[model samples]
Target: MSFGLEVMVRSALSHIGDLIAVSLGISLSLNNLLTFYADRPRAILAAHKKFMLARVAELSLLAAFALLYQQYDSLYINTIIDTAAAQFDAGVPLHWQAQVAACLIALAALIKCAQLPFHGWLIQVVESPTPVSSLLHAGVINLGGYLLLLFTPVVAQSSIAIWLLLLVAGLSTLASALIMTTRISVKVRLAWSTCAQMGLMLLEFALGLYELVLLHLLAHSFYKAYSFLNSGNAVNDAIRLRLSSAAKTSFQQAQTSNTVVPNAQTWLMAFSISLAVVIAIRSLFGFDGAFSAWWLFALALTVLIVQWRTCEHSPSIIYTIIMGGFLCVIYAALKQAMHYVLPSYSTLTVQAFSLADIWAMILFSLLFVLSAFLHYQVRWRAVRRLSIALFAGLYLDEWLTRLVLKFWPVTLPARTKQQHHAKSTHQPSLKP
Candidate 1:
């Protein structure tokens, strides 16, 4: 793991560094397969197949890169970035080779990040040890984002590649988020959350929010690591929370109320306050293209307000306003900090809204509305049906599981005599 990170650090100097990093990442994943071999033979085999597929995609990306650059010297990171930026500035469309390279890069990263149909292995691997799961989620899964960040210049210029990424990652994000809500096990929920988070990270890349992507990457790494490590206490924490007065009240209210959706007036107030806070912070920090951030902040604050109202424990208006403003301020500050640290060329600067921008705005707005609807309208018949489908992950993974097993079938390891004896010893007597 340390070696993979070190190689990534060198990725800025040479494109070869990314290849090496990806190789080391696959090696790490293969090593984890060893740990899963005995108890989860099927999972190990499936994960191996996925990892090999990713390796193949990475190799294809390397070939595409060579074809696009046409020389070893021009393959250096700075040269590629300069060439891409020059083309972009000149309003020159990307050549077909460059477009292919960009698409290959996105494909490789998506597989590595475990997006959608490629995500079954991520869930299956949870049978492994907790630390292994932590390392996989917190470190290995993020390599995809790093890959995209390294080639941001090439990707930003390829409209086809961007749209491809947007469609896949956007669906993955929404599906995984809703699926997470249906899972009961803590680790399973976290795994689904990781998938959703990775999807969102890739979506950010597709939208050319490189700085925000970096910030999201760092924050998610720390949070996932800690969450996985501390998951043992999750049940106890849930019990305590449920025993609390506020929680009990909220639960009862949710159970008894026929209509849980907040009034339009409440939503309007929340939006107004959140917008005001974001605008204030934006003016202070001089940040641009923060529409997505504003939507997220509003959603979070609205959820909080709705919860408080449901419990009949609404906080003072001033205090709520202050907390909402504080949250927005923190987000803006982190974004600005990332912008200042990264090189100017690494982050794409948007001077005006494009068609892609408008589409992205619509997507985020839909996601916001969908999230609110799913949360508050669980009692609705249509929502209940949708929730059931989501709980089964829309049967997405089942197809992949069947396909992988059919073509490259793996047998479960035979049990040893000692294991068989233990099972017999634990069995109830036939006489009873």
Candidate 2:
């Protein structure tokens, strides 16, 4: 859910370096495959095509905004935002043009972030080199959040746009998360995770958890960079671990653990811990003057509690409490630091908390709870069927891929045996 907070600090911390870094990051990422054309030409082309589509979406959005501002009295972004807010406060309904413009911005961000139908290209990105993947997952994909953060002052006024962004981003997060589990290939799974992470970040932004979104943006970037770079070794480590286990037991392969779903006792314990922690935090911190973000906080606490309860090695209860306390403190401190560094431009108005916000919170909470239930019920027939659907990517991406191919078919000719033989044996005559 969205929150309303009085801006205790109103520093505009915009820096040229931030903009330059983001621009360069995006530029480098889009062209990261340039050096790999000889090795992965087809992959590069596919990614390039996807990038072009995203570029078009962004360009169109900017064009719309430019035309919009031309008709308005102010050219400054903040000034325009202030005027829109004042008008909205005065009971003036948002113009149809503005609503459309906001929707366009959301659409562009959705494409850039690789949400839903736009995600087919990201999956194919495994064909690219590792460095490219690192650059993409670490830097480029994060720009979608940056885009939303940048325009919140204006975009927040459009309820339609906010709802659209919430629904699309929320659905993308759910679908990608489920699909990720069905993938066996490491890179594909990582790509799916990236998509889901990006979607969740956008959803966080929509829910007015800007601080959490910023934290997520930075943390996920570093994590994904390391994950991609070390991905090759992960398979070896898994094999080695399996071999060591086999050596200590029967030669026949041991079944994978089915204890991912916590038993009822564990669930009760986790929920109790989570509730206690929430109550303690609320009593101590007084909701940080924003009770609207409570549900998200509660959800995080629940996830942490579950992680603590389901650990293979039993951790001391006191240690778990201390760790949770440390995490809470660190999160609060980091959120404060982010406010100073990336100061938001918008004021928290009542409209920020809309029906869309409630629906988004409900959807995400349901997804998390459903995920826990499904994990525990892995052996159920219905669960298996759902897994199959998820494995097929809910047939969403498959249909979109076909549509994309039909509209923009790959025309590059393949190097057949005859073509390779001719190229090898009948080289061009040497120039004099």
Candidate 3:
């Protein structure tokens, strides 16, 4: 390679810079070409070989990039590359310098994941089956958080840079999330959740507390995946949607011999497990007094399980609305609690990963095993639900945050409806 070509290629291939341009280009092209050749579903399934082969080509280029870019050569290749290294390497104590480099490297990897060109290949990706969307959302696109988590050890050491990255990403993601409308399939929403969560993870990196972020990522991923997969094609779950809980109760009353299908023992077990989780989380955080969020979460989960088991026996419309409402409430309450109590922190490797913290890896392994087992059931509709839901949750979270910041300007008097109500309530007190 000529010096200029070598410099350009090497800069593009940095550990942090990795294989984005090529992978994105390939993903975009195959996605577009296959879509043109076939209808949405057929193209997705039939073109898997081609799509995967394209991914292989991209990844192979990345591997080559990794090998070639190991030189750290100072041809002053690109301003962006130099700036990133300088920022990562600057003013840190020598002992912690490597740690900072590691974090910058991690940050670069994450940006690559979330920072694709927004040219709209995402739309086609969602048109595949619900399960695929959910898997892509909660599993693949979602990898950014874990990548950030993996590098938290090095990132936490860099005080100013990490915070700046967090703020910029949060603002950008919040803005982008708001612009995304309901025109896209539900899977896009899940993908956006990956964007939003990755932003939050960046914030955690900046904040220097990786444990909570790690915990959050792990828990978040599985639950999100499960939910997206389950809820993706709920439009077609016939018997469950028609009957309401009240109707079921009435039926039980009318027909004494009703089998009650759920196997009460299983219900009881689930409830106990749910309750224990509530108490454990509450104890860990001391939020809402002792058992506050626990009560809300438990109640919602209970209703959800009951609704799920009885959904086949009920009406789709009622079941869906009720289930959706409960889920929203659950999500809102959890976010609120986290905002109030948790200090966002990064889990930099030196901080989060010790020889002792090998346990996290072990725990992750177990989670993977459990996920495999759960996925063995593999209903197409279920996967679709999980995918769409994760994205929607992410999109909604970012959108609402943006809306408040933009219109309400919480610092201003009339920024929020709650603030307006507060002022109104105090006006009477002041007058009296």
Candidate 4:
């Protein structure tokens, strides 16, 4: 696994890197299946089944690349990028072959990144050892986004391929992010978070924001690794947080006759402040795509405002404003650093406005509004139903699981009396 990853990092622009990376992914999947087969045979088998499906898609991607090599007489990624970029600059559409290859690549990436129906494997793998789960989420799962970034030039030239990634990743991002909140287990929540983060990263790639993708990849890796390694402390942390929240709630009830919910004007003020802060930071950094960046900033700021409103004794407004500005500055600086370090094609400037960008902005706004509604309107009947559906992942994974098991059944070992007793006594229950 180590050797495969090393080769992947060192030779990412070559065919060998792609081969080794996919091989490593297969090896890891098999490793997870085998390592815990004795303890959780059913889950391991299901995970392996999904991995095999992903393998087929990845093999198709490789075959597509081979066809591209035949047409272009080159397998080097840099050469393909140059060819695609030149064609794009000259207003020539990508060859049909390149378009097919890009589409196949997108399909493989979506499956590998655990989007939607394929995400059950990622959640199941939490049954493995903590270290294994950490490595998988932090290091291996991100290879899908890496694959997309490596072929950015080709993907950029194919509008069909780009939109395929955009639509799938966008839905997965929104669904997974919302679903994660409905989970109770720390590791399960983290697994869903990885799904969401991967979706968002792929969405950024589809939007031609390669620099942002790189930064996101690195930051998520570290964060996930740390979260997994420290997950043992999560129970204690949750207890402390609940206690503090209870105390805060009691104090707020005592101090105020009514809850001080933020009105439309307060939301407007927060949005305006967030927009100004983002614009100022982007302007200072000489960044493009200010409008897209502002949407993200506004979403974050509004979430912050909602949290503060719930707390009632959170930081003062001036401190909140200062922290918001500081965060924007930090984000801009990191993005600028990414632009400086990445390759020219990966850092190519995007248009100020496009259909995809506009759609993504609208999606962000919708998510922001949804989050606020869910947090504030918990008593609403529709919200309760929506929360239940989200918690169940809308049964998307269940249909896939049933289909896989029906076609490719696995034999289970006979259950011992002790195992049966334990199962009867402590059957697992879902938590909201």
Candidate 5:
């Protein structure tokens, strides 16, 4: 329904349906919040409160777009485009007010999508019922990307808006992906992973890969839905798999060796293999397009292929190569199909990787390498401290919870003294 509304808004050049669609999107988010309220899990009440506040911010920013519509005296989004085009023709930049409106809209998208700083709410939304979590993660929250895609003409005109989306979304992707690895609980990890994936989706929109965004949006929706529905069975399945593997290994000598951590030399080899594969694909598939989306996809595939070779229980080289080739071919084919099937409502323009973008990618690469090193190497004091911080989500959410509570006190359900006493008395002894 949201997608249908978005399609209508995009197709209707003169209707005020954009505002209506955005309003409906917000309503859906509010519904999710209301569902959370009904369940009201005591453990996550504070998190739910923060989530509500973030939604309020999101709602406000989305509502603010109405001001722009009124200012132009036309309910049509074409007004924004025609005005900007006129300004561009006249060798004039967009008005400051227009830029401000664009930034506000982008910020709203960031909040809706649960990017960093505002990200605490999203990671903590695990308190919601699994169905709500599935709906929020899979369906509702994705409207942010749609919003950006819908308003690309106005939003992309402002350099401030562009940089804001890029930095915030990119950093959020990096931070959330890193933080997700340190989490232990299955649901919490899934929540963090959602945050990371949202960040990545937003980042892709900022890069003007709308087709890729659509593909990701569809794929993630199905995957997240299945994951959340089957979440309860995850532990059971893991245990069963472990037992089965143990049974199979009992008759043979067990290999209980420590995992071999890939050293610098191994990393170099992997890098070389990845590069060669990328070059081979480019040469064979005539993917020598602009140094943009294809290159990134190739690099990602290269990394996966390397991991397939090095990771525990690694697949055979022949199988890995075949899988990599299949993935590359399928992705390229799908991207090409989407190019024809999905029409763009606005001109897609993202400046090729700026220094900031490059630096961010480099930083993420370094963090990933260090994390892998720490995971396998002897746990030094520094590694331990880093791991602790990551495990605690860098205390980022905790701090946000504190600040939010300071301003908006959440009234948690009061526990009886007897309940507290019972909890205290029931603390399990560690003695074996």
Candidate 6:
């Protein structure tokens, strides 16, 4: 917040941009060099050498950053804010400790721009299949979010930071969506969309209230992950490209039509339902304030499912049982992890083996066994049913269990028995 420090921080941020630009330049230069000399059979030796050198460049930078943080005790580059965060706020002499935050912010920004070692072989990626490109450059990568999250304290405090993130997310989204229209390659469009979505999430984290940020991130990540995993769009595009390439005499280009009706009713219904759900959830949860609701998550999931193009039909009873069993596996993993990390939470036992805990455990142990038996549980109907059930459970935890229990306490059979015994003994004494 101090004048000089702010200037220095901005300088550091600019440095990050500069680093990204430099990395981009180097990457493109390597591309051209590879194109010209990389193709020669004899260049295979040189290719290996160049690859090794690029790897070295990446590793060296990473190590230097690590060493700088380690040897310099005054340098505080740790994730958790130390004096540097404060000093970064103060214009104090770049205490060896404080300069690191700026450096880290810079580092994270640059690392984000490059998309890192995964896409290090620039020529190879530029020549990759569409699906691969989408997954690599656009869809699957999550480092940007991680980086932003890592430095949220620094970034979130400033309006410019929020605006920058919004610009990135918004512009990327628009560019990708627009480009998708012109792109013959579906996967490429998907990649662009992913980048845009990621930017949106980063923007939301920067601009929105802090509470909404993580949930937004969670939802966006999963939705994007789902789309990236089963992207038939790219495959479809590949087929179209192949068809176009095939002999013209043997086949005719398929006629396209704009007859597909824009389903306004469905969109309206979905939006209404989603909004209703958020309001209902908040109300049911008995949120501290009235009318405070958020449904970014549900919408994201719904979008992903809709895009996956699924249909529903009744699942066999056996299949449902099998799916329940899968939930058991998930529950088991969750419990094990929770137990390992949070031993004190075991106090969450539901009142000395009440129907709640008993049923929960039985359900946990049984559901997955059943699901395993009914392992062919791929139908959307089954998935929908399971999802609805899960949502019901979440509602119970978030709303009913908390709010309802506070007002209406449960009466255990043991308590009832004890009361009866006490009354019986008093009656005998009174008669005497």
The most accurate candidate by TM-score is 4
Q: Which ten residues in a row have the lowest lDDT in candidate 5?
A: 286-295
Q: Any residue pairs clashing in model 5, and if so which?
A: none
Candidate 4 — which residues are off by over 4 angstroms? 1-13, 16-30, 33-37, 239-260, 346-350, 423-432
For each candidate, the alpha-carbon lDDT, in order, equals: 0.74, 0.68, 0.45, 0.75, 0.66, 0.39
My TM-score estimates for the predictions, one after another, are: 0.85, 0.79, 0.39, 0.87, 0.82, 0.39
Query: Per-residue error at 19 for model 5, in Å?
Result: 3.5
Clashes of each: 0, 0, 43, 0, 0, 15
lDDT for 374 in candidate 5 is 57
> How well is each residue in 1-432 modelled by candidate 6, as lDDT tens digits?
233323423444334334344544554455344434333432333233334434444443454345445534423333232343454456434443224433444334433433212122322333333344434443224545644543444444344445454444444433333333333444444544554455445544543333333444455566655665566666776577667746342345334322222244643444454445544544554332111113333343233323322223534535533443443344333323322221121111123234322332343234323332232332457654654453232232234223433654433223244446768787432110
Candidate 4 Cα RMSD after full superposition onto the native fold (Å): 4.4
lDDT of 3 by residue, 114-187 (tens): 43222133334555556655555555554445444433333445554454454555453443343343225355
Pairs in steric clash, model 1: none
Question: Which of candidates 2 and 3 is the stronger one according to lDDT?
Answer: 2
> Can you write out model 5's per-residue Cα lDDT over 1-432, one digit (the tens) per residue?
134434545575345465556556655555555445443444345455556665665566545556666556666665655565556556676667678878888887887777777777666666666787787778877877766766666776778887787788887877787788788777788778887888777766666666777778788889888888789898898778667967557424335655655667756655665556656665676532223455556556655666666765888766766677777678767765655544443343454455544644564565556556556663678777777777777776677667777877767655555556767899643311
Model 5: lDDT equals 0.66
Candidate RMSDs in order: 4.7, 6.5, 18.8, 4.4, 4.6, 28.4
Let me know the TM-score candidate 6 reaches against the reference structure: 0.39
- Candidate 2 is scored at a TM of 0.79
Candidate 1 to native Cα RMSD, angstroms: 4.7
Best candidate (score: lDDT): 4
